[model samples]
Target: MKLLLWLLLFVLCWPLALLALLLWPLLWLLSLPFRLIGISVEAVFALLRALLLLPARLLGHRGS
Candidate 1:
């Protein structure tokens, strides 16, 4: 789908399309730190949830 849009843009304006192609990797690299931080935060929340639920799990409780 994105490829089709880029192809259309390439037809309409070659320069911008080429520029986007060139800059895409740079944009991805710039976003990596943010993605990593989001993953780390999610893991922390998951760990907290498991810790909070540990006592119930140890007591053999069933969840619905």
Candidate 2:
């Protein structure tokens, strides 16, 4: 519903929509580095968690 209103506004004010379209790619490009850093940080944390759990997993497998 909100999207429909926005589209209506865009139709009524085309220049605003055009400006938003032009800036979208630039904004995404600027944010790409931060996104990459976030992904790397998440991966590092996942690896650390797996390392921490390895001993427990091995013990469980031996018992089974």
In terms of TM-score, which candidate is strongest?
1
Q: Which lDDT value does model 1 have at 43?
A: 100
**Candidate 2 residue runs with Cα over 4 Å from true position:** 1-12, 61-64
- Estimated TM-score per prediction? 0.75, 0.71
Candidate 1 whole-model C-alpha lDDT, 0 to 1: 0.94
Cα lDDT tens digits for candidate 2, 1-64: 9999999987889988789999999999999999999999999998998898889888885433
Off by over 4 Å in 1: 1-11
Worst 10 residues of 2 by lDDT: 55-64
Clashing pairs in 2: none
Candidate 2 lDDT score relative to the true structure: 0.91
